[model samples]
Target: MIDTDRTAAITAVLDSLADAWARGDGDAYGAHFTEDATYITFVGTRYQGRDDIAGSHNTLFAKFLKDTKLAHEVLDVRFLGADAAVVTTRGDTYKGEHPKKLTKVQTYTFVRQDGHWLVAAFHNTQRKPLMEAISFRFAPETKPKAWPAQLLDSVS
Candidate 1:
Protein backbone atom coordinates (compact mmCIF):
# COMPACT_ATOMS: atom_id res chain seq x y z
CA MET A 1 0.00 0.00 0.00
CA ILE A 2 1.09 3.55 -0.71
CA ASP A 3 1.83 5.88 2.17
CA THR A 4 -0.09 8.97 1.14
CA ASP A 5 1.14 11.02 4.10
CA ARG A 6 4.75 10.40 3.25
CA THR A 7 4.09 11.14 -0.39
CA ALA A 8 2.48 14.42 0.56
CA ALA A 9 5.43 15.32 2.72
CA ILE A 10 7.86 14.65 -0.08
CA THR A 11 5.85 16.75 -2.53
CA ALA A 12 5.62 19.53 0.03
CA VAL A 13 9.38 19.76 -0.05
CA LEU A 14 9.23 20.35 -3.79
CA ASP A 15 6.61 23.02 -3.29
CA SER A 16 8.88 24.73 -0.80
CA LEU A 17 11.74 24.67 -3.27
CA ALA A 18 9.63 26.34 -5.95
CA ASP A 19 8.46 28.91 -3.48
CA ALA A 20 12.01 29.73 -2.50
CA TRP A 21 13.12 30.07 -6.10
CA ALA A 22 10.16 32.33 -6.81
CA ARG A 23 11.38 34.62 -4.08
CA GLY A 24 15.04 34.25 -5.12
CA ASP A 25 15.85 33.14 -1.60
CA GLY A 26 18.89 30.94 -1.98
CA ASP A 27 19.18 30.24 1.72
CA ALA A 28 15.59 29.15 1.93
CA TYR A 29 16.00 27.06 -1.20
CA GLY A 30 19.10 25.28 0.06
CA ALA A 31 17.48 24.54 3.42
CA HIS A 32 15.36 21.92 1.69
CA PHE A 33 18.50 19.96 0.88
CA THR A 34 20.66 17.89 3.21
CA GLU A 35 23.84 19.28 4.64
CA ASP A 36 25.92 17.09 2.34
CA ALA A 37 23.71 17.13 -0.68
CA THR A 38 25.07 16.93 -4.21
CA TYR A 39 23.55 19.04 -6.93
CA ILE A 40 24.36 18.75 -10.63
CA THR A 41 23.09 21.35 -13.05
CA PHE A 42 22.05 20.78 -16.64
CA VAL A 43 25.19 22.55 -17.80
CA GLY A 44 27.27 19.95 -15.88
CA THR A 45 28.33 22.15 -12.99
CA ARG A 46 28.40 20.11 -9.81
CA TYR A 47 27.94 21.60 -6.35
CA GLN A 48 28.83 19.76 -3.21
CA GLY A 49 27.18 20.37 0.14
CA ARG A 50 24.26 22.59 1.00
CA ASP A 51 26.46 25.61 1.53
CA ASP A 52 27.89 25.34 -1.95
CA ILE A 53 24.41 25.07 -3.41
CA ALA A 54 23.15 28.04 -1.44
CA GLY A 55 26.13 30.26 -2.16
CA SER A 56 26.17 29.51 -5.86
CA HIS A 57 22.47 30.10 -6.13
CA ASN A 58 22.82 33.38 -4.32
CA THR A 59 25.15 34.53 -7.08
CA LEU A 60 22.83 33.22 -9.74
CA PHE A 61 19.75 34.73 -8.16
CA ALA A 62 21.43 38.12 -8.13
CA LYS A 63 22.52 37.93 -11.73
CA PHE A 64 21.47 35.49 -14.45
CA LEU A 65 18.46 34.14 -12.59
CA LYS A 66 17.22 37.45 -11.29
CA ASP A 67 13.44 37.77 -11.26
CA THR A 68 13.04 34.19 -12.43
CA LYS A 69 10.41 31.78 -11.17
CA LEU A 70 10.60 28.05 -11.41
CA ALA A 71 7.74 25.95 -12.71
CA HIS A 72 7.59 22.20 -12.59
CA GLU A 73 5.28 19.22 -13.07
CA VAL A 74 5.86 15.98 -11.23
CA LEU A 75 6.23 13.08 -13.60
CA ASP A 76 6.85 10.22 -11.22
CA VAL A 77 7.54 9.54 -7.57
CA ARG A 78 8.73 6.19 -6.30
CA PHE A 79 9.54 5.27 -2.76
CA LEU A 80 12.85 3.47 -2.38
CA GLY A 81 11.91 2.55 1.18
CA ALA A 82 10.18 4.11 4.12
CA ASP A 83 12.75 6.88 4.33
CA ALA A 84 13.82 7.51 0.74
CA ALA A 85 12.14 8.52 -2.49
CA VAL A 86 13.10 9.25 -6.11
CA VAL A 87 11.09 11.85 -7.95
CA THR A 88 11.16 12.83 -11.63
CA THR A 89 9.84 16.15 -12.83
CA ARG A 90 9.67 18.38 -15.88
CA GLY A 91 10.66 21.94 -15.03
CA ASP A 92 12.01 25.25 -16.24
CA THR A 93 12.77 28.74 -14.98
CA TYR A 94 10.99 31.70 -16.50
CA LYS A 95 10.95 35.41 -15.91
CA GLY A 96 7.56 36.34 -17.32
CA GLU A 97 4.69 34.06 -18.25
CA HIS A 98 4.92 30.45 -17.10
CA PRO A 99 6.19 28.25 -19.87
CA LYS A 100 3.61 26.29 -21.82
CA LYS A 101 5.95 23.33 -21.63
CA LEU A 102 8.92 22.92 -19.36
CA THR A 103 12.13 22.19 -21.27
CA LYS A 104 14.14 20.37 -18.68
CA VAL A 105 13.89 17.11 -16.80
CA GLN A 106 15.00 16.92 -13.21
CA THR A 107 15.53 14.03 -10.83
CA TYR A 108 15.52 14.45 -7.07
CA THR A 109 16.48 11.98 -4.42
CA PHE A 110 14.93 12.65 -1.05
CA VAL A 111 15.81 11.12 2.28
CA ARG A 112 14.01 11.51 5.55
CA GLN A 113 16.24 13.13 8.14
CA ASP A 114 15.30 13.75 11.75
CA GLY A 115 11.62 13.36 10.86
CA HIS A 116 11.85 15.80 7.95
CA TRP A 117 12.22 15.01 4.28
CA LEU A 118 15.15 16.65 2.49
CA VAL A 119 16.73 16.35 -0.89
CA ALA A 120 19.94 14.30 -0.73
CA ALA A 121 20.84 14.74 -4.36
CA PHE A 122 19.53 16.42 -7.47
CA HIS A 123 20.30 16.21 -11.20
CA ASN A 124 18.93 18.41 -13.92
CA THR A 125 19.02 17.80 -17.67
CA GLN A 126 17.91 20.01 -20.53
CA ARG A 127 15.80 18.14 -23.05
CA LYS A 128 16.48 18.36 -26.76
CA PRO A 129 13.14 17.84 -28.43
CA LEU A 130 14.54 17.30 -31.91
CA MET A 131 17.05 14.76 -30.72
CA GLU A 132 14.42 12.99 -28.65
CA ALA A 133 12.01 12.84 -31.54
CA ILE A 134 14.67 11.47 -33.85
CA SER A 135 15.61 8.80 -31.35
CA PHE A 136 12.00 7.88 -30.70
CA ARG A 137 11.18 7.73 -34.38
CA PHE A 138 13.98 5.31 -35.09
CA ALA A 139 13.54 3.38 -31.87
CA PRO A 140 9.96 3.39 -30.72
CA GLU A 141 10.91 1.19 -27.77
CA THR A 142 12.85 4.09 -26.31
CA LYS A 143 9.68 6.09 -25.86
CA PRO A 144 8.37 6.35 -22.34
CA LYS A 145 5.24 4.32 -21.72
CA ALA A 146 3.46 7.33 -20.29
CA TRP A 147 4.06 9.40 -23.45
CA PRO A 148 1.08 9.70 -25.72
CA ALA A 149 1.53 7.90 -29.04
CA GLN A 150 -0.12 10.74 -30.95
CA LEU A 151 2.52 13.17 -29.78
CA LEU A 152 5.34 11.07 -31.14
CA ASP A 153 3.45 10.42 -34.30
CA SER A 154 2.97 14.14 -34.87
CA VAL A 155 6.63 14.81 -34.18
CA SER A 156 7.77 12.06 -36.54
Candidate 2:
Protein backbone atom coordinates (compact mmCIF):
# COMPACT_ATOMS: atom_id res chain seq x y z
CA MET A 1 0.00 0.00 0.00
CA ILE A 2 1.28 3.47 -0.88
CA ASP A 3 1.19 6.16 1.75
CA THR A 4 0.74 9.65 0.35
CA ASP A 5 1.78 11.16 3.64
CA ARG A 6 5.10 9.32 3.60
CA THR A 7 5.62 10.26 -0.02
CA ALA A 8 5.14 13.93 0.83
CA ALA A 9 7.65 13.63 3.64
CA ILE A 10 10.19 12.07 1.29
CA THR A 11 9.63 14.84 -1.24
CA ALA A 12 10.21 17.42 1.50
CA VAL A 13 13.53 15.75 2.31
CA LEU A 14 14.65 16.03 -1.30
CA ASP A 15 13.47 19.63 -1.51
CA SER A 16 15.42 20.50 1.62
CA LEU A 17 18.49 18.84 0.19
CA ALA A 18 18.29 20.87 -3.00
CA ASP A 19 17.69 24.07 -1.04
CA ALA A 20 20.75 23.35 1.07
CA TRP A 21 22.89 22.73 -1.99
CA ALA A 22 21.75 25.96 -3.61
CA ARG A 23 22.60 27.84 -0.47
CA GLY A 24 25.96 26.07 -0.11
CA ASP A 25 25.01 24.71 3.28
CA GLY A 26 26.76 21.37 3.53
CA ASP A 27 25.64 20.67 7.07
CA ALA A 28 21.98 21.09 6.21
CA TYR A 29 22.39 19.04 3.03
CA GLY A 30 24.01 16.20 4.95
CA ALA A 31 21.26 16.29 7.55
CA HIS A 32 18.85 14.71 5.07
CA PHE A 33 21.08 11.62 4.67
CA THR A 34 21.52 8.79 7.11
CA GLU A 35 24.76 8.29 9.04
CA ASP A 36 25.71 5.34 6.80
CA ALA A 37 24.49 6.83 3.56
CA THR A 38 26.39 6.30 0.30
CA TYR A 39 26.55 9.22 -2.13
CA ILE A 40 27.80 8.86 -5.68
CA THR A 41 28.38 12.07 -7.63
CA PHE A 42 27.60 12.55 -11.30
CA VAL A 43 31.31 12.32 -12.06
CA GLY A 44 31.35 8.90 -10.30
CA THR A 45 33.10 9.93 -7.08
CA ARG A 46 31.78 7.92 -4.17
CA TYR A 47 31.45 9.27 -0.65
CA GLN A 48 30.64 6.82 2.10
CA GLY A 49 29.04 7.92 5.34
CA ARG A 50 27.38 11.24 6.04
CA ASP A 51 30.53 12.87 7.39
CA ASP A 52 32.50 12.22 4.22
CA ILE A 53 29.62 13.40 2.08
CA ALA A 54 29.29 16.60 4.06
CA GLY A 55 33.02 17.24 4.19
CA SER A 56 33.57 16.79 0.46
CA HIS A 57 30.56 18.93 -0.36
CA ASN A 58 31.74 21.61 2.07
CA THR A 59 34.96 21.98 0.17
CA LEU A 60 33.22 22.12 -3.20
CA PHE A 61 30.58 24.54 -2.01
CA ALA A 62 33.27 26.87 -0.70
CA LYS A 63 35.21 26.80 -3.93
CA PHE A 64 34.01 25.51 -7.33
CA LEU A 65 30.33 25.44 -6.42
CA LYS A 66 30.15 28.67 -4.48
CA ASP A 67 28.09 30.42 -7.13
CA THR A 68 26.20 27.46 -8.48
CA LYS A 69 22.42 27.58 -8.42
CA LEU A 70 20.46 24.37 -8.33
CA ALA A 71 16.91 23.56 -9.40
CA HIS A 72 15.45 20.15 -8.65
CA GLU A 73 12.16 18.47 -9.49
CA VAL A 74 10.89 15.16 -8.20
CA LEU A 75 10.26 12.95 -11.22
CA ASP A 76 8.89 9.93 -9.42
CA VAL A 77 8.74 8.18 -6.06
CA ARG A 78 8.02 4.50 -5.48
CA PHE A 79 7.58 2.76 -2.18
CA LEU A 80 9.53 -0.47 -1.79
CA GLY A 81 7.87 -1.31 1.51
CA ALA A 82 6.57 0.46 4.57
CA ASP A 83 9.99 1.76 5.49
CA ALA A 84 11.70 2.06 2.13
CA ALA A 85 11.20 4.14 -1.01
CA VAL A 86 13.02 4.94 -4.27
CA VAL A 87 12.93 8.47 -5.65
CA THR A 88 14.00 9.92 -8.96
CA THR A 89 14.74 13.63 -9.43
CA ARG A 90 15.78 15.85 -12.27
CA GLY A 91 18.28 18.56 -11.35
CA ASP A 92 19.66 21.48 -13.28
CA THR A 93 22.69 23.43 -12.17
CA TYR A 94 23.33 26.92 -13.44
CA LYS A 95 26.61 28.76 -13.25
CA GLY A 96 27.39 32.00 -14.97
CA GLU A 97 30.88 30.91 -15.98
CA HIS A 98 29.63 27.64 -17.36
CA PRO A 99 27.03 28.72 -19.87
CA LYS A 100 25.97 25.18 -20.68
CA LYS A 101 23.39 23.91 -18.19
CA LEU A 102 24.45 20.85 -16.25
CA THR A 103 21.43 18.61 -15.96
CA LYS A 104 21.40 15.32 -14.09
CA VAL A 105 19.04 12.59 -12.99
CA GLN A 106 19.43 11.68 -9.33
CA THR A 107 18.08 8.53 -7.73
CA TYR A 108 17.75 8.26 -3.99
CA THR A 109 16.93 5.32 -1.79
CA PHE A 110 15.15 6.42 1.33
CA VAL A 111 14.56 4.45 4.48
CA ARG A 112 12.50 5.29 7.52
CA GLN A 113 14.70 5.33 10.58
CA ASP A 114 13.81 6.59 14.02
CA GLY A 115 10.50 7.96 12.76
CA HIS A 116 12.12 10.03 10.06
CA TRP A 117 12.88 9.45 6.37
CA LEU A 118 16.54 9.61 5.45
CA VAL A 119 18.48 9.05 2.31
CA ALA A 120 20.30 5.72 2.48
CA ALA A 121 21.83 5.79 -0.98
CA PHE A 122 22.12 8.39 -3.72
CA HIS A 123 23.39 8.22 -7.31
CA ASN A 124 23.63 11.09 -9.79
CA THR A 125 24.17 10.76 -13.53
CA GLN A 126 24.21 13.21 -16.41
CA ARG A 127 21.02 13.44 -18.45
CA LYS A 128 21.29 12.58 -22.10
CA PRO A 129 20.32 15.13 -24.77
CA LEU A 130 16.84 14.84 -26.25
CA MET A 131 17.83 13.15 -29.50
CA GLU A 132 20.37 10.86 -27.85
CA ALA A 133 17.86 9.86 -25.23
CA ILE A 134 15.24 8.97 -27.85
CA SER A 135 17.75 7.16 -30.04
CA PHE A 136 19.02 5.02 -27.21
CA ARG A 137 15.53 3.59 -26.70
CA PHE A 138 15.33 2.07 -30.18
CA ALA A 139 15.13 -1.72 -30.21
CA PRO A 140 18.39 -3.44 -31.22
CA GLU A 141 16.88 -4.84 -34.42
CA THR A 142 15.46 -1.43 -35.33
CA LYS A 143 18.61 0.54 -34.59
CA PRO A 144 20.06 2.44 -37.55
CA LYS A 145 23.24 1.16 -39.16
CA ALA A 146 26.07 3.62 -38.62
CA TRP A 147 28.23 2.57 -41.51
CA PRO A 148 27.36 2.19 -45.22
CA ALA A 149 28.95 -1.28 -45.30
CA GLN A 150 26.79 -2.42 -42.43
CA LEU A 151 23.68 -1.12 -44.15
CA LEU A 152 24.54 -2.95 -47.40
CA ASP A 153 25.27 -6.17 -45.53
CA SER A 154 21.98 -5.97 -43.67
CA VAL A 155 20.02 -5.43 -46.93
CA SER A 156 21.64 -8.56 -48.48
Candidate 3:
Protein backbone atom coordinates (compact mmCIF):
# COMPACT_ATOMS: atom_id res chain seq x y z
CA MET A 1 0.00 0.00 0.00
CA ILE A 2 1.13 3.53 -0.72
CA ASP A 3 1.41 5.78 2.28
CA THR A 4 -0.10 9.27 2.27
CA ASP A 5 3.33 10.91 2.21
CA ARG A 6 4.41 8.92 -0.84
CA THR A 7 1.16 9.75 -2.61
CA ALA A 8 1.70 13.42 -1.93
CA ALA A 9 5.20 13.25 -3.38
CA ILE A 10 3.93 11.60 -6.53
CA THR A 11 1.21 14.22 -6.87
CA ALA A 12 3.83 16.93 -6.55
CA VAL A 13 5.81 15.48 -9.43
CA LEU A 14 2.74 15.48 -11.69
CA ASP A 15 1.87 19.04 -10.67
CA SER A 16 5.39 20.20 -11.41
CA LEU A 17 5.28 18.60 -14.83
CA ALA A 18 2.10 20.47 -15.72
CA ASP A 19 3.53 23.70 -14.37
CA ALA A 20 6.59 23.26 -16.57
CA TRP A 21 4.46 22.73 -19.67
CA ALA A 22 2.42 25.80 -18.85
CA ARG A 23 5.64 27.75 -18.64
CA GLY A 24 6.83 26.32 -22.00
CA ASP A 25 9.87 24.81 -20.32
CA GLY A 26 10.37 21.50 -22.06
CA ASP A 27 13.53 20.66 -20.15
CA ALA A 28 11.73 21.06 -16.85
CA TYR A 29 8.72 19.16 -18.16
CA GLY A 30 10.82 16.15 -19.12
CA ALA A 31 12.81 16.14 -15.90
CA HIS A 32 10.04 14.34 -14.04
CA PHE A 33 10.39 11.28 -16.32
CA THR A 34 12.87 8.43 -16.23
CA GLU A 35 15.69 8.17 -18.76
CA ASP A 36 13.96 5.37 -20.70
CA ALA A 37 10.41 6.62 -20.33
CA THR A 38 7.90 6.27 -23.17
CA TYR A 39 5.58 9.19 -23.91
CA ILE A 40 2.60 9.06 -26.25
CA THR A 41 0.94 12.24 -27.44
CA PHE A 42 -2.76 12.77 -27.84
CA VAL A 43 -2.39 12.22 -31.58
CA GLY A 44 -0.78 8.82 -30.91
CA THR A 45 2.78 9.80 -31.80
CA ARG A 46 5.29 8.21 -29.47
CA TYR A 47 8.49 9.60 -28.06
CA GLN A 48 10.99 7.28 -26.46
CA GLY A 49 13.57 8.28 -23.84
CA ARG A 50 13.89 11.49 -21.92
CA ASP A 51 15.89 13.18 -24.67
CA ASP A 52 13.29 12.51 -27.33
CA ILE A 53 10.47 13.67 -25.11
CA ALA A 54 12.28 16.86 -24.23
CA GLY A 55 13.38 17.51 -27.79
CA SER A 56 9.96 17.01 -29.33
CA HIS A 57 8.32 19.17 -26.67
CA ASN A 58 10.95 21.85 -27.14
CA THR A 59 10.12 22.13 -30.83
CA LEU A 60 6.40 22.18 -30.13
CA PHE A 61 6.70 24.78 -27.39
CA ALA A 62 8.75 27.01 -29.63
CA LYS A 63 6.06 26.90 -32.29
CA PHE A 64 2.31 26.27 -31.94
CA LEU A 65 2.49 25.73 -28.19
CA LYS A 66 4.39 28.92 -27.45
CA ASP A 67 1.49 30.77 -25.88
CA THR A 68 -0.41 27.80 -24.56
CA LYS A 69 -1.17 27.17 -20.90
CA LEU A 70 -1.85 23.75 -19.44
CA ALA A 71 -4.68 23.02 -17.04
CA HIS A 72 -4.91 19.62 -15.40
CA GLU A 73 -7.24 17.80 -13.05
CA VAL A 74 -5.94 14.61 -11.45
CA LEU A 75 -8.76 12.06 -11.58
CA ASP A 76 -7.14 9.09 -9.84
CA VAL A 77 -3.88 7.60 -8.57
CA ARG A 78 -3.49 3.92 -7.82
CA PHE A 79 -0.40 2.20 -6.55
CA LEU A 80 0.64 -0.97 -8.37
CA GLY A 81 3.08 -1.71 -5.61
CA ALA A 82 5.39 0.01 -3.16
CA ASP A 83 7.45 1.48 -5.98
CA ALA A 84 5.02 1.85 -8.90
CA ALA A 85 1.78 3.75 -9.52
CA VAL A 86 -0.64 4.76 -12.26
CA VAL A 87 -2.16 8.24 -12.39
CA THR A 88 -5.10 9.31 -14.50
CA THR A 89 -5.77 12.94 -15.35
CA ARG A 90 -7.84 15.20 -17.54
CA GLY A 91 -6.10 18.17 -19.13
CA ASP A 92 -6.88 21.10 -21.38
CA THR A 93 -4.69 23.55 -23.22
CA TYR A 94 -5.61 27.20 -23.57
CA LYS A 95 -4.12 29.71 -25.93
CA GLY A 96 -4.89 33.33 -26.67
CA GLU A 97 -7.76 34.06 -29.07
CA HIS A 98 -8.39 30.37 -29.56
CA PRO A 99 -11.03 28.12 -28.10
CA LYS A 100 -10.01 25.16 -25.96
CA LYS A 101 -9.34 22.75 -28.81
CA LEU A 102 -7.85 19.84 -26.96
CA THR A 103 -9.26 18.02 -23.96
CA LYS A 104 -7.27 14.87 -23.22
CA VAL A 105 -7.21 12.08 -20.70
CA GLN A 106 -3.67 11.21 -19.69
CA THR A 107 -2.42 8.10 -17.97
CA TYR A 108 0.97 8.26 -16.33
CA THR A 109 2.77 5.26 -14.92
CA PHE A 110 5.37 6.12 -12.34
CA VAL A 111 8.10 4.08 -10.73
CA ARG A 112 10.34 4.85 -7.78
CA GLN A 113 13.97 4.79 -8.82
CA ASP A 114 16.83 5.66 -6.50
CA GLY A 115 14.34 7.02 -3.96
CA HIS A 116 12.57 9.36 -6.39
CA TRP A 117 9.39 8.89 -8.35
CA LEU A 118 9.67 9.30 -12.12
CA VAL A 119 7.24 8.69 -14.93
CA ALA A 120 7.88 5.34 -16.64
CA ALA A 121 5.17 5.59 -19.28
CA PHE A 122 2.84 8.40 -20.23
CA HIS A 123 -0.10 8.13 -22.65
CA ASN A 124 -2.46 10.93 -23.69
CA THR A 125 -5.68 10.48 -25.63
CA GLN A 126 -8.55 12.77 -26.56
CA ARG A 127 -11.68 12.67 -24.41
CA LYS A 128 -14.86 11.91 -26.30
CA PRO A 129 -18.17 11.62 -24.47
CA LEU A 130 -19.99 8.64 -25.97
CA MET A 131 -23.38 9.74 -24.71
CA GLU A 132 -23.17 12.80 -26.91
CA ALA A 133 -22.34 10.75 -29.95
CA ILE A 134 -25.38 8.57 -29.42
CA SER A 135 -28.98 9.86 -29.31
CA PHE A 136 -29.36 9.12 -25.61
CA ARG A 137 -30.35 11.90 -23.23
CA PHE A 138 -30.96 11.92 -19.50
CA ALA A 139 -32.60 14.54 -17.33
CA PRO A 140 -32.99 14.77 -13.59
CA GLU A 141 -36.73 14.08 -13.80
CA THR A 142 -36.39 11.31 -16.36
CA LYS A 143 -36.00 7.63 -15.51
CA PRO A 144 -32.61 6.10 -16.09
CA LYS A 145 -32.23 4.28 -19.38
CA ALA A 146 -31.65 0.56 -19.30
CA TRP A 147 -28.87 -1.01 -21.26
CA PRO A 148 -29.70 -3.61 -23.90
CA ALA A 149 -28.65 -7.01 -22.56
CA GLN A 150 -27.52 -8.09 -25.97
CA LEU A 151 -24.94 -5.33 -26.07
CA LEU A 152 -23.54 -6.20 -22.64
CA ASP A 153 -23.67 -9.94 -23.32
CA SER A 154 -21.81 -9.52 -26.59
CA VAL A 155 -18.97 -7.73 -24.85
CA SER A 156 -18.83 -10.27 -22.06
- Maximum-lDDT candidate: 1
Candidate lDDT scores, in order, read 0.89, 0.79, 0.78
Answer with 2 or 3, whichever has the higher TM-score.
Answer: 2
Model 2 TM-score, all chains together? 0.78
Model 3 spans with C-alpha error above 4 angstroms: 96-102, 130-156
Model 1, range 24-137, lDDT digits (tens) per residue?
999999999999999999999999999999999989999999999999888778899889999988899998999987888899999999999999999999978898888888
With a 3 Å backbone cut-off (N, CA, C), the pairs that clash in candidate 2 are none
lDDT of 2 by residue, 1-156 (tens): 557899899988877887898899888888888999999999999999999888888899999899686777776788997899998776767765433433677889999999999999999998555544355456445444542232223232
Provide TM-scores for the models.
Answer: 0.91, 0.78, 0.78
As for lDDT, the candidate ahead, 1 or 2, is: 1
Candidate 2: worst-modelled 10 consecutive residues by lDDT? 147-156
Q: Which ten residues in a row have the lowest lDDT in candidate 1?
A: 147-156
- Candidate 2 or 1, higher TM-score: 1
Q: Flag regions of model 1 displaced more than 4 Å.
A: 146-156
Whole-structure CA lDDT of model 1: 0.89
